[model samples]
Each structure stands twice: as C-alpha cells, then as structure tokens.
Target chain A: MPLTPNDVARLADLARIELSDEELAGLTGQLDLILESVQVVASSVPPETTPTSHALSLTNVFRPDEVRPSLPVEDVLAMAPAVEDDRFRVPRILEEAA
Target chain B: MSEPIFASAADLARDLAAGTLSSEEATRACLERIESSDGDVHAFLHVRADEALSDARAIDQRRASGEALGPLAGVPIAVKDAFCTTGSPTTCGSRMLEGWVPPYDATVVRRLKEAGLVILGKTNMDEFAMGSSTENSAFGPTRNPWDLTRIPGGSGGGSAACLAAFEAPLAVGSDTGGSIRQPASVTGTVGVKPTYGGVSRYGLVAMASSLDQPGPCARTVLDAALLHAVMAGHDPSDSTSIDAPVPDVVAAARAGDVAGMRIGVVTELSGEGYAPGVEQRFQEAVAALAAAGAEIVEVSCPHFSLALPAYYLIMPSEVSSNLARFDAMRYGLRVGDDGSHSAEQVMRLSRGAGFGAEVKRRVILGTYALSSGYYDAYYGSAQKARTLIIEDFDRAFATVDVLVSPSTPTTAFPLGERTNDPMAMYQADLCTIPSNMAGNSSASFPAGLAPEDGLPVGFQVMAPPLCDDRLYRVGAALERVLTERWGAPLLDALAGRDRLSEGGRA
Candidate 1:
C-alpha cells in the first residue's frame, strides 16, 4: 500500500524533522519513486532463499565477558545536554492529575 | 608551480625519508594549492594548515632523533568528514552535526597518525553518506575538478576531487554502495573498497553499518596500497573487524602482472544501461587485460538483477537502527521541547529537525519494513535475495578469478540534476552495488576520458572475498597500460589542455 499524507506526517514527526509544505511535497514525490523501485525487490526475489543481513560470510562474533573500569559519572555527564541528580533528565511523559 | 603539491605520495615519502624534501615544504605546497583552487573545487570542509605544519615539525624531530620511520611518513592525506577526528568537527556534511566534535580518532585516523602522515583536513561528503552526489551536503556541493559545473561522485566526492585538484596526495573514503568507487571513477582517481571487515569501522559515523567500509583514495594504486596496509587491521572496538593478517598491499600492487589470471567480465553488469563512453572504456580495459596474458571469460551473475533492491531493503533497515541513537537528548543538536512534553516527543522533534529528507524517508521505509506485520514480506524477502546475490558471486568466482565492469553507469552528472529525484540518482550505483553486497574487494581506476563530454571514465576490478590484493595488482597493471596509452593518467590529460588555454600556448 502507498503511504498517505498522514503517514508521511507521522513519519516526519517520529523522525523529529520539521518539514515545510514545499519540502514535504518534494519528499513525498521522491519517496514514492524510491518505494516503486524497491518494490521490485520485494516482488521478484523468491521466498525459498534466506535473506542476507551481512555481506561478509562470517558469523557469531562474541567477546569474552570482562569488566572494565567505567569513566567517572561526572566525566560522562559533562557532554550531556541536560543532566540533574547525576542522571539524564527529560520532559515528563505522563500528564499531572487535574 | 612546485611539484610537491602534485607529486605522488610514494615520491613524497621517498624524498621526505631522504631529507631531500622537508615536511613543512610539502604541507605549505598543499595549503597553497588549496588556497588557489579550493574556491572553485570546494573539495575541503576544513583546512588545518597550522596544525599540519606542527605535525610536520614533529615528524622532522622524529627523523632527527633517528627513529625508524613509517612507510607513509610526512605525506599529506585528506579524510572524508564521516571519519571522526579528535579535534575537528566530524559533520558527515549534515547540519545536525554542525558543531559535533568526536572525542577520539577513528581507527583509520589513529592508524594514519601512527604512520606519521600529516592530515591536510576533512573533505566534504553527502549528508550521512546517503546520496550519490555531494549535492546532499548541507555545507554545499563538491564540484568535479575536471568541470566545475559537474558533480564529483559522492559520498566520497570531496576526497576524489581533492586528489584530482592536487589538494592532497591521499584521502580516506567510505563505501556503502559505490560511495568510494563511483566518485573515483568520475574524478579519475584510484579508489579501493576493501573486503568487508578488512578495515575497522570503530570510529566511523554509522551509515548502514553492515555495508560501510572505509578505504584509501589516491592518484595511483601503490599509494592506495600503502595507505591500506596501514589502515587494515583488527580493532577490538569494532566487532566486525576481521582477525586475520593483512596482505602486503604495497608489494602486491607493485607486481604489475596479470599472467595466468582468469579474468571474468560480469555479463550482468556490462553492456546495456551503461553510457556508451563508459562501455567503450570498459571494453578497452578488458582487451588490455587479455593482451597481458589474462584469460578473459564471460561470467553470469543472474541474481545480480536483484542486488539494488536487496541492498535498498537491507541497508535502510540497518540505517534506521544505527541512526536511532541520534535523538536530541544526546551529544548534538536539540529542538522543540519546553520541559513539558515526553521524552519520546523530544526525540521525535529532534530527529524531525536533524535529519535530511533522504535520511528520514529511508528511516521510515526501514521502520515499516521491520514493523511487526511487514517483517516477513519486506525485510525478510530482501534478506533472501541477498543470499542469492552472494551465491551468484560465489558461483561466478568458481569459473573466474576476478570480475570486471564499469564502476558506475555514467560519469559524473551535472550537480542538482538528480538531487530532487532520489531513485534516478540511485540508478548511478547500478554496476557497483553488487560487489559491496557480496563482501568482495573492488577497485576503480581511470580507464580513459570519454570524448562525448570530455569526462573521465573508470573501470572496476573485483576479486572474491579476501583477494583484495588481487584487485590492487590487476588495477595497477591495467592502470599502467591505460596511462601509457593516454600519455598520462586521464586527469592530467584534461589539465594539460585546460592549462594550454590559460597560457594561450597550445
């Protein structure tokens, strides 16, 4: 199914980009074209084959469990845009009771 | 003009080691070249002339102390902005990262610094390495040095243009699809995309993590090899880094013989859908290989027809996951929060403002592909196609030692022509994407110029996984033959005629 304008708007909202009307129109056209081309991939390749996620043939790379000293909390927080009480702070998700 | 700016990296290294040329002298020459040509070429996003001089002085001090030198000591090199540099802003040509500075060096940057090379600066690139041309850069489009109005290929265009313009002897570029080879082909420089996991991706800004591989860009094969030798190694920080010995690339490149090599021309990649000039040069390259004792044969990779689609599906899926970490609450830009909304709302607002249209579209497509109801139909099917693509490559390699094709369907297109038409631009990678999908090593070097528009065309050479050394060997041999035929590398041919008009001496 093709994406509706609402779908496009929701995606933009989810992506956190403020799109101007003109930009949204241009992107809508481009997205439609891209979707059309990629649809061929969905339709053509048979179902029996296993999908490839990596180009390299290697598999199952794991590291030994080991503890390493972490950087100081203050040092880590130094780069954060907003921090309070030694933790990252953000806008409240739930509304207050009336 | 001093030859230092345009001289090859190998030559610069030899002179610097012998004290015949000072590192300061070479750095100054590169700075002067950038000062003169960068206004037209727009190859660089930053020029670190002062720090380059300081680094050169350190190299001189090390030489004075009689310390054993690295192979590429004192050579000036450029890095695509996607590679994180400790002090410089590693923007990846996106506005969201306008002031973002990495706290540490990328693995490639660390290795280059250890090798004693002087960094000229970061080159321009497509935002998040998403576009085929550099026009997607928030900073501006990087121009093709051959023709100012035309594009240099992307997301490595800036590096290729720097090599062509003599701004630096070497540059580092990343390849996801044809990001490395396509630009190199159009700009008439040498580009190598090593086998996946051959180079560490520890410090690179993620763009389709599974497909992104950083490699060397230079005017000659040996210089690329020299840089590759230093850059290719295991890094514990990058889980995908291969833990095997790196082949002696310099030695392999210097072996300019393809005798007894079974060279295959990928039937699926040739002929139709290619520019006539590009096809002509590709045929000439094949003929040259045959003349040099290579047994040329036709190899069919039938499933290659589905490569682009499979690639689009898998790459965007991975891109969505990788770019998810860039929410405004983190290191970079933040927007649209008055301390009342939820964390999810803040993330949505930041990403909406931060990412470009192409990136956002892919993320949405990817999210949809991976969504609960659509996983089996879209992303899963794409994965299955990928297996077929790999099988095709493996089957073809059984008959032929290496495969050959044009690096891209066309040479550089005019800037802005395909900028708004995303799929039209995506078609540019038609010939080049399959190799990346298969995790094979590939190289692009100039084939001759196309008389139709006077643009340079490049021929691609591919070898099965871990046979990266062979790509360099065949590339160097064929490049020498072509260069000798044209009297110089293709870029120099244009420069000579271009200079004739400037001096009125032709």
Candidate 2:
C-alpha cells in the first residue's frame, strides 16, 4: 500500500519530527521502494500460521513488587527543560474531562 | 606495568590473580591508549578517567588484602553510549539526549561493575543505533582505524574501533541488526550477538526493542566470552529476559574444539553478487573448520529471502514508537517556544532541530507502518513473517548444530560511499538481519583479509537460540586457525601501515 502525503504528515506529527517538503518528497520515493521490497513478507507465510510473540517460551517472570526509592525529584527534574515548583512543566495534557 | 595493554581479558585476569599486573596499571594503560588514539579515531563519546582509576585502585587494594575478585577483575571495558550509567550521561550519540544523565545504571552496566571491570568510557554510536555507518552520530562519525577515511561500521562502530585501535581490550555494543558483528567483521575484531532476551535490556535506550541484544566486542574470543558471561543471566527488571541458566561461555570458548560439530553452510548466504574476495575468505574459513574435524553441509532456509524486507518494516515501525519519548517536555536537549507560541510548536521545533536526517527518516517510516489502514498490511504482516523466520531457524537447527556464512556481502566501504544512499547501506545487512529476526545467537570474527582491497572480512557463525556457547567454541577454533595461517592475528598485519606518513597523519 502506498502512503499518502497527508499520512506522512500525520505520522511525522505523531513521531514529533518535522519533515521538510523536499524530505517528504524524497521519503515518498524511498519509502515506496522499501515498502515494495518488504511486501514480500505478506506472501511468505500462510495466514493461519500462529504469530510467534517471542523466541523463547519462559513465562510469568515478574519482579517482586518491592517499593524502591527513585532518584530525588531535584535530580529527576534537573534534566527537564521546563520545571516549575519541582514539577515537570509540560503543555497541559488534560483539558478538564468533558 | 602496562604489560597487559593489549592482553585478552583471560590473560589479564590470570596475571592480576598471580600479582603480575595491578588493576590500576591495566586501567592506566587503557586510559593512556584512549588518550593517544581517540584524537584520531574519535571512538569515545565520553571518557570517565578519574572514576575508572578510582575503581581500579579500589580493586588493587582489595587484591592486596587477599580479597576475592571477579572473573574479569581489573579489566577495562568501554560501554556503548546507548547504555545508561548511573553518573554518566548516556546520549545514544544524539543531540536530543546531549546532557541527559540517567540516575541509575543499566542492567549490563551494573553487571560489569559487579564483575569488577573498570569502566573506561562511553563509546560513540549512530543516533539511537539507527545507521549502518556512524555518520548519523551527532558527535560526528567514528573513523575506521584501518583506514581513517572509511567507516568503522555502525552503530557500534566506536566500540569495535576502540578495540581495533588497542584502546580497550573489551567493549560492549548492542546489536539490533548486526551492529556488533558487522563492525567487528570490518575491523578484524571479535563480536557476538547472543540470543535476544539472553542479556537484560532494562537500561538500553530502546531502538528496535525485540531485536536489540547487548553483546561484547574484543580482540579475542575469550575476551568477548568473559565479558559475555558476566553480562548474561536473568534480570527481573527486564520482562523479556530469559530465566535460563547462563551457559559457561568462557569455558566453552577455551575448549576450542569443533570436532564432531555439524556446521551448516547456508546456501542462501553464498554465491554470486557476494564480493569475490569476501567469498574467497569465507571458503578459507570453511576449510579451516573442516580441518578441525567439523563437517560442513549446505542448508537452505527459503524464508531468509524475506528477512531483509521484514526487518525494514518491523525496525522502522518500532523506531517510530520507541523514539516518541523524546518530546521537548520530558528531558535532555530541547528548544522551546515562549508563551507566545503553543506547546505543540515547541515540540515541533525541538525535535526538528534535535534529530539527524536518517533518524527522522526512520521515524517517518515507522509512523507510516503503524498508521491507520497500513498497520494490518505492514507491521502486522511483518511480525507474522518474523514467526516464519524463527520457525525456519528452528527446523534448520534440528538438523545442524550451527550455521555459517559470510558476515557481510562486502568489506567496509569508504565513509561517504553509502551514507548518501540509505537503501544501499540497508542492503549490506541483508545476510545478518535474519538471525536477529529469528532471535538466534550469532558471531562474527575475522575470516581473513580481502585480497582485492586488503581489508578484513569476517565469517558469521549462528547457533540454536540458547546454544550461544557453541558460537564461541567454533569462533575461537576458527580464530586460532586463521591467526596461525596468517602467521599472526590480522591486527599485526597492519603494523607499520597503522600510522600514516607525517604529511597524511591526522
């Protein structure tokens, strides 16, 4: 399947990358070649074959629910670009539930 | 005192145990080598000299007091920039994480420290391990020690180059799609990519999550095996880590006997289009294995033809999702807009300026894979194809104990040759990517030098998922044979040529 320019634009947005017009144009052709090459996988196997989630079959390997102390807030926030009152300042993700 | 500068980890450990060399001296020699070589090779992104020396001094003092030391005690090893260190910045060679230091060490980093290995520094890499050549590194590409104008191989080029330049005896590198093995092959070093989940992935900056396996790079198989043994074993922090017992990798490598080993030569990996010199060296490696009492038989995994394509889809899709964490708000290098502009604008500006061109290209491709309507046709189907590749490997393993092939289609090309052509560079990994997709263990060691270009070529060895120990055994056996045939290790062949004339020297 071919990707529309709008599809590329939306993907770039979701990935937080800004694509230039020339880049998008070039990506269109390059991606087309790659997609076509990889499309061979579609017919490589039967549809009924169960998909393998992992190579090995060990299961239920979970860490004990021990509460460990995290790095101090000061150190954690130190790397952030915008911090206010010990909180990471981001463009507010919530706009009050409708 | 610097007697162990270029010694293997095994030799260094033995000597340290016998009081022939102190941990401090070993660390100092490595530091001195890095100081002299890094100016030209640019192998390290960050060097922690004081901390490393301090750790070495402590180990020496402990030994002097008759205290026990770990198997790799006193050895200095370089960590790839992708792994987080508690106090050191783990940038993954990208501007996005330029100043972002993790407060905790990666599982591998903690393991290395626990094993008493001195941390020399952080090596450079492709941005998020994304490129075939280190050209994508925000800090600039690591030059090949064999020829400065050529690439060292990515994204673990710096790790391999450091060992090749005799700066570090052992280094860590993550192989998502042949990053460890490819660079090792090009630089005449030893590297292994253990089965996925064999090494904990807890602190590695995620690239292609399912495919990334942290492995070792060193001058000798025993050195790589020693580091590998320490890095292996289960980690509860990494949900994907296997609970199986870590095999005796160092002992297996020392055994060095392939007698009665059923080695399968993959038919798909041989023949036309492969560089003649690469094929010649590969054949020589095969003959050496046969002379060591191993039987080589042709085996075919037809699904392998689909591996490269499957990898392209799966890798990009995963990269897009994994890299989404680097928005302007969280951490690291960011360019933000004032109150006049919206938050979205700040994210856009920051990411646009932060990422290199190749990284952006992958992110776009990945996003497209996960996009509505295309998900079923691309990512979903590619994953199903991954199942087929794994099954194919399983069936082949049932018949043969191990598989062998040329590590790459060609020797290391000039630096600028494939950087401009991403598709061509991607094709170079076609042979090695299948093993990663199947979650099998594979290794690459110098087979011989390509007669055409006089550059090194590597032969790859693959084994059943948990049979990683076998790769070391076979690789070590072949390393011995090839070294003897060449009259010395490949590194010695380039002795005088290593340093250029005063006019051309960097």
Candidate 3:
C-alpha cells in the first residue's frame, strides 16, 4: 500500500520529528517508492522461518555487579545542552505541574 | 612532498622502529599533506596537528629510551567522526552533535591511543552513517580523490579518501552495510569489515547496532591487518563483543597465497545491474586466483538477491530505535527551547532540524514498519529474510573457503548523481549488504581501474564468521596479482596526477 502524506505525518509524530507540510509531501512519495522496493520481504521468505534479531547467537550477556569507575558528574554535565544544579535542564515537561 | 608521505603504514612502522625515521617527522608529513590536499578532498572533519605531533614526539621519546612499542605505534591514523573521542568532536557528520566533544573515547579510539598511534583527527561521514554516498553528510561530501567530480563512496568516504589522497596512511571506519568497503573500493584503498562482534562497538554512535562493525582502512592489505589486530578483540564493555581470539590476519595477509584453496564466485551478486567494467575486472580477478592454483567454482546463493530489501527494513528499524537517544533533554542540538514550547516540542523540533533528509526518511519508514499493523509484514519478515541469507552463506561456505564478487555494481558515480533518488543510492551497496546481513568478515581490495571510466573497482571477498583471515588472504593475493599486472599499485595513477600538478608551474 502506498503511504499517503497523512501516514508520513503520523509516523513523524510517533518518531518525535516535527516535519513541515512540504517535507511530509516529499517524504510520502520517496518513502512510498522505498516501501515498494522493500515490500518484497513479506512474500520473499517463508512464514515458518525463524527471525534472526542478531547475527550472533548471544543471549543474556550479563556482567557481575561490581562497582566501576564512571565518567565524573561535572564532565558529564559539561556536555549537556542545558544543565542546572548538577542536573540536565530540559524544557518543562508539564506546564501545569511547573 | 616526500616519499614517506605516500608510504604504506607497514613501511612507515618499519622505518620508525629501525630509527631511520622519527614519528614526529611522519606525523608532520601527514599533517602537511592534509593541509595541502584536504581543501579539495574535504576528507577530514577535524585535524589536530598539535596533539598529533605531541603524541608522535612522545612515541619518539619512548623509542629513544629503548622502550617497547606496538607495531603501529607513532603511525598517524585518521578516525571516522562516528567514533567518540575525548578531545576531538564526534559529529558523525550530523548537525545533531556538532562540536560536541565526547566525554570518553570509543573502544576503537582508545585502542588506537593504547597502540601509541597518533590520532590526526576525525574524518567526515554520512550523518549517523545513514547514506551510502557521503553527499548526505551535513558537513559536505568528501570528493573522490581520483576524480573530484565523483563521490568517494560513503559513510566512511572521508576515511577512504584520506588514504587515497595520502592524507593519512591508515584510517578507522565503521562499516554498517558497505560504509567502509564501498568507500575503499571507489577510492582505490583497502577496507575491511571484520566478523560481527569481532570489534567492540562501545562509543561508536549507534547506526544499526546489529550490523555496525569498526575496521581498518589502508593502502595495503597488510596495513589493514596490522590496524585490525590493534583494534579487534573482546571488550567487556560491549556485551555483544565476541569472546574469541582475533584471527591471525597479519600472517594471512603476508601469506598472500590462494594456492589449492577453494574459492566460490557468488552467482547472485553479479550480472545484470553490475557495470561492464566492474564485471570485467571481477572476472579477471577470479581468473587470476585460478591461475594462482585456487580451485574456483560458481556457487548460487538464491536468497542473496533478497538481501537489499531485507537490509533496508532491518537497518532502518534499528536506526529508528538507536537514534531516539537524540532527545533534546541531553546532549546535541536542541531547538524550540523557548518558554512557550514544551520538552516534547523541543525534542520534535531538534530532531527535525538536526537530521538530514535521508535520516528523517529512514526514521519515519522504520516507525511505520514497526507500528502495530505493519510489524509482521515489514520488520518481522525482513528478519526472517536475514535468516535465509545467513543460511545461504552457510551453504556456500560449506563447499568453498571464501566467496568473491564485485564490491559494488559500478565504479564511483558522479557527485549528485543519486542524491535525489534513494533507491539508486541504495543500489550502490547491493553486492555488499549480504555480508553485513550474515555478520561475516568481508574486505574490498583494489581490482584495478574500470576499463571505461578509469576509476577504481573493488574486488570483495567474504569469509564465514571468525574466519576473517581468509579475507586478508584473498585480498593480499588479488592485490599482489593486480599490482603486478598494473605494473604498480593502483593509487600510483592518482599519485602520478598529483606529481604532475605539483611539478607544473601554475
């Protein structure tokens, strides 16, 4: 099924990317072409075939709960776009709560 | 310009060890080359001449004090900007993380420093390693050194271009799909994608976590092997890292022998879609291996044709999930932070503004595919297709020691050729995606110039996981044969042009 501009706009919202109407229109066509090419995957493989999420068969890779040196707080905070009082300063999450 | 500027990493290492050359001198030569050529090449995103000299001088001092050092110590190497470095910015060719200096080094970068290799600077790449052509890079495309009008194949284009342009003797590139090998092919440099989990992925800004593998790029197979040895092996920090010894790639590279080895020609990866010049050179390479006493047989991997469609689904799915960390709450570019806009609005605006078109396209595609209704039809089926591709490799490797194909369908296409067409751009990696899908070891060697375009073609070799040595063996053998046939290394043609420009009075 060819994706419409509405589908791309919905997807952009789900992906947390604010796209303009122009971008949504352009993406709809390009993405439709790409989806058309890749849609063969549905028919190409047998349904009974098991999916391989990872190339290797590794599972439940766990390490001992040991204390390790971590990056310093100041160093970590220095890279933040906005920081205040040793915390990452983000835009207000809830306007009423704020 | 001096001879050492274009010397192989192996030769430079030997000279440094023999006390005939100082690390400072070699570092300076590379820095000077970058200064002179990188303006046109645009291979580097960042260059740290002062830090590189300091590191080289430290290595020189250690050598003078009779202290032991690794083989690659004091060798100047360019790193792809995707790898996080403490001092240098790790942009990954995206405005998202522009000028963002990483708090720590990537495992590969840490290893490079541990080996005493001088870090010259970070090279450009596709934003978050998304596009096949470096044209998607926000910084700008890295021009092909051979022909400035053409693209140097990407996301590792800068790393490959630096080697081709003699800016750096060795470079490190992360290959998701054909990022490293394709760029290497077009620029006439050597690149390897080691077996998945063979190299630690820690600190490598995730593109597709399952497929991304960092490897070495160099002028020669042995130099790639040497750098590979320094970079590969298990790291506890990366849970996916394989707890196994690195294959003896250096010995295999030096062996350069395909004698009595059974080599397979992947039937699906060639013909139709493949350019005539690329097919011609690949067939000649197969013949050369046959002449070297290797038994050649055609192996049909039917499912290989489905690799491209499957990769587009799987890679984008992973990309969507992986790139979600770029929320405006933390590091990287944040937009719409004015009091009126909420945090969510800021995240939406930042991601929309920071990412390039290709990135946004894939993210949306992935979000659609992974959505409630389309999950099984798109992402799940693609995963199943991945299983079949692996099985095909298994069946092929059972009979043959290694598989060979044209690394790309054609030589480097002109810049802006496929910028408007994502499908055409994705076709550049048709022959290369199967290896990544299977997590096998693959490398691209110079397969002489394409007869029509006079541009470089890459001969790709694939080996089963942990059997990465076989790739070096095949690459070295072909490099030897092709170099002999061409009467010199393939890059000599590019260097000859450079000499002309240098010798000519303006």
Candidate 4:
C-alpha cells in the first residue's frame, strides 16, 4: 500500500516531530520506496521463525544491590538546557485535572 | 614531527617508553598534523589541543619520575564523537546535541584514559551514525584522504579519515550496520567490530541498542588489537556486557599465522554489484591467504541476500526508539520555546529543526513500522529475518574458522554521487551488515588499491563470537603479505596527491 501525506503526518505526530508540507510530500515517496524494497521480508521469513531482540540472549543481569555514587547534581544540571531548583525545567506539560 | 605523525600507534608506544619520544612531542605532532591537513580532511569535529597537550605533559612527567606506565601510555588517539567525554562536547554529528557535554566518560573513554592514551579530540561522524557516508554530518562531510573529491565512508568516516590522513595513529568508532568497517574499507585503515557485548556500551550515543558496538580503528592490525585489548573488558555498568575474559587479540595479531585455518568465502556476498577493481583485489587477497597456507572454501549463506532489507527495518525501528530521548526536554537544542507553546509543541518544533533529513526519514519509517496496524508486517518480520541470518552464520562458522568478503562492494564514489539516493547509499553496507545482525566479531583491513580508480579496497573477515582472535590472525597475515608486496603502506603512494582544490577535484 502506498503511504499518503496524512499517514506521514499522523506518524510525525506519534513521533513528536513536526514536518513541513514539502518535507511531508518528499518523505512519502521515499518511505514508500523503502517500504516496497524492504517488503521482501514478509515473503522471505517463515511465520514460525522466532524473533531476535538482540544478538546475544543474555537475561537478567544484576549488579550488587548496594548504593553507589551517582552523578552529582551540579554536573548533571550543567547538561540540561533548562534547570531550575536542582531539576530539569520544561514547558508546561500538565493541564488542569478538571 | 613528520616521522611521529605517520608512525604506527604501537611504534609510538615503544618509542615513548624507550624515551626516544616524549608524550608531549608526539601529541604536538598529531595536533600539528590536524592543524595543517584537517582543513582538507575535515576529520575532527573537535580538537582538544590544550587538553591534549596538558595530558601529554602529565604523561611525560610520569615517565620522567621513573614510574612505569601502560603499554599505550602517551600514545595519542582520536575518539568518535558518539562516545561521551566528561568535559568535551559529544555531538554525534547532530545539531541536536551540538554542544552538550556529558557528566561522565564512556567505558571505552575511561579505559583509554587509564591506559594513558592522550585524547586528541572528538572526530566527526554521520548524524547519530545514521547515514552510510559522513555527508550526513550536520557540520559537514569528511573528505577521503586518498582522493579528496570522493567520500570517506561512514558513519565512522572521521575516525577512519584521521588514521588515513595521519592525524591520529589510532581512533575509536561505533559500528551499527557497517559504520566502522565501511569507513575503514574506503580509507585504507583497520577497524574491528568486536563480538556483540564484547565491548561495553555504557555511554555510546545509542543509534540501535542491540546492534551498536564500539571498536578500535588504527593504521595497523596489531595497533587495533592492542587498543581493543584495553577496551574489551566487561563493564559492570552495562547489563549486556559479556562477563568473560577478553580474548588475547594482540597475541593473535602478533602471531599472524593462518596456516591450516579454514576460511570460507560467502557466495552470496559477491558478484554482479561488486566493482571489477574491488573484486580483483578481493580475489588476490583470497589467493594470498591460500598462498600463506590458509585453506579457502566457498560457502553459501542463502539468507544473506535479504539481510540488507531486514537491517533497514530493524535498524530504523531501533533508531526511532533510541532517538525518542532527543525530544527538547532536558538537553540538546530547543526551538520555538516561547512561553505560550506547550511541551509537545516545543518538542515537535525542536526535533523538526534539529534533526537532519535522513534522521527524520528513519524516525518516521520506524514509527510507521511500530504503529498499531503494521507491527507484525515490517518490524516483526525483519526480526525473524535477523534470526535466519544468525542461523546462516552459525551453519557457516561450524565448517570454517572465519568468513571472508569484500568489505564494501565498491570503492569510494565522488561526494554528492548518492546524496539524494538513499537506496544506493544503503547498499554500501550490504556486505558488512550480516555479521552485525549475527553479533559476530568482524573487521576490515586494506586489501590493496583498486587498479581502475587507484583507491583503496578492503578485505573483511568475520569470526564467531569470542573467536575475535581469528579475525586478527587472518588480517595480520594479509597485511604482512600485502605490505611486503607494496614495499610500503598503501597510503604512502598517494602522499602528495591527497589534497585537491577547495572547489573540489582538479
């Protein structure tokens, strides 16, 4: 199925990225070509084949449950674009619970 | 200064310890080389000249005080920007984190530092190691040292270019879908992607978590092996790190004996798409190994052809998930942050402005794949294909000690050749991706120059996990044979011709 501009726009919204109309139009064709080419996987892989999440099947790695040093507040805050009161500050993220 | 710039990292280490070369002198030589030629190579995104010189002086003082230092003490090494440095900006070639300095060092960085290697600078790369060529760098593309008009393969292009241009004797790079090996291939350097989980990934800017690996880049096999030895120990900080003794790869490189070892040639990895000159050099390499008494056999990995398509899906899916952290919240560039705009709006605006076209393309594609209706069709199927590729590798490695192929299908093409063609650029990683998917140890060594274009071609060796020594063994043998035949390093032939007009080629 060919991707429409609306599809890309919805994806952009889900990804939290904004795109111009020109970029949206441009990406539609490119993504379509990419999908069409990679669609070979649908035919190539057998349904019963197990999916691999990683190259190695390592599971449940645990370090000692002891307290250790973490990054100091001063150093951590230095990397933040906006820091206030020893924490990261961002634009308003909440609406009233009403 | 001239002699120090072109010396191997191993030789530099020996000279530094013998008191024939001081760390300060060597560090100054590399900085001078960067100052003189980096304008043409565009290899470094950041050169820590003051920090490097001070670090070098400290090492010199330690040596002068009669204290024994590590083997690589005082050696200058370039680091890929993907790895964080505590005070230096780690851009990963993206405007998003243009000037973001991390609070701590990556495991590899800490290891190199403890080993007494001077941190020369952060080398440039494709944005978040996304594109196959360094052209995707937001700062600019890194030009190939051999032919300035051609591209330096990437996203580890800066690391490879540093070694090729003699800016640094050794460097570090992250490989996901052929970033390190492909760049090493075209630039005539050595790059190794150790077995998955072999090297810790504590602070590498995540491109694809599962496939991402940090490895060594150097001018010679043994130098890469020595650097690898320093960085490959298990780090308690990374959960996926393998808790096993690191393989003695330096010994293997020094041994350089491949007699009676069975090397397999993957039938699916070569043929129609391979440039004639690349194929010619690869076959000669195969013959050279045969002459060195390493038995060569042809093996067919039928699932290999579909590896590229599956990689595009899996890699982009991971890219989308990994890059989700870049939403203009705590760190990196923030755009349209007016008080009136909401958090989501600011995030959208920032990402829209900060990300490059290739990055945006992958994010959208990945989001599409992982979306509600399409999950099983694209992302799920690709993971299954990845499993098949691993099984194919298992079957092949069962019969052979290692697998061989041309690192890339062709030599470096002119810059802008594939700028608009994603598929063409994507194909550059074709031969190098299967090993990545399988999480095997793989490396690229300069095979020889391509006769037609007079550019470098790379020979690749893939070994089963934990058998990384085999890669060095074979690579070292080939390097020895090829060096003997050429009578010098391949880059020396193009010594004075590396520069081109600022407008591009002559």
Per-model chain A TM: 0.72, 0.78, 0.91, 0.91
In angstroms, how far off is B504's CA in candidate 2?
6.1
**Candidate 3 falls in which docking quality class?**
high
Stronger candidate by TM-score (1 vs 4): 4
What TM-score fits each model?
0.95, 0.96, 0.98, 0.98
RMSD score of candidate 4 (Å): 1.4
Q: Which residue window of length 10 is worst by lDDT in model 1 chain B?
A: B497-506
Fnat: each model in turn: 0.72, 0.66, 0.92, 0.88
Candidate 3 error regions (>4 Å): B499-506
lDDT of 2 by residue, B1-506 (tens): 23566677788889989998988999999898888778888999999999999999999998899988888988899999999998888999999999788978999999999889999999999999988779899999998887887888889999999988888889999999999999998999998999989999999999988889999899888888989999999988898898889878888889989999999999998777689999999998999999999998889988888788888888888888788888888687667556644567677878888998888888888888888877877888887888888887888899899999999899988889987778788977878899889899999989988999878898999998888999999999998898888777787654435462221223
CAPRI accuracy category, model 2 = medium
Candidate 2 C-alpha lDDT tens digits along A1-98: 58667767777788777778887777777777777777778766678766654556657765578899988888788788888888988764433352
Error of 4 at B149 (Å): 0.9
**lDDT tens readout by residue for model 4, B1-506:** 24898889889998998899999999999999899889998999999999999999999999999998999999999999999899899999999999999999999999999999999999989999998779999999999988888899999999999899889999999999999999999999999999999999999999999899999999999999999999998899888899999999999999999999999999998989999999999999999999999999999999998899999999999999999999888789998877877888989999999999999999999999888978999999999999999999999999999999999999999999999999999999999999889999999999998999888999999999999999999999999999999998777765545463343543
- How do the candidates rank by DockQ, highest first? 3, 4, 1, 2
DockQ of each: 0.61, 0.59, 0.89, 0.83
**Model 4 docking tier (incorrect/acceptable/medium/high):** high
Model 4: lDDT of residue A69: 88
Candidate 3 per-residue C-alpha lDDT over B1-506 given as tens digits, one digit per residue, 9 for 90 to 100? 24888899999999999999999999999999999988888999999999999999999999999999999998999999999999889999999999999999999999999999999999999899988779999999998888888899988999999999999999999998999999999999999999999999999999999999999999999999999999999999899999999999999999999999999998888778898999999999999999988999999999998999999999999999999999978799999887888899999999999999999999988898899988999999999999999999999989999999999999999999999999999999998999999999999999988899888999999999999999999889988988899889999887777732342211
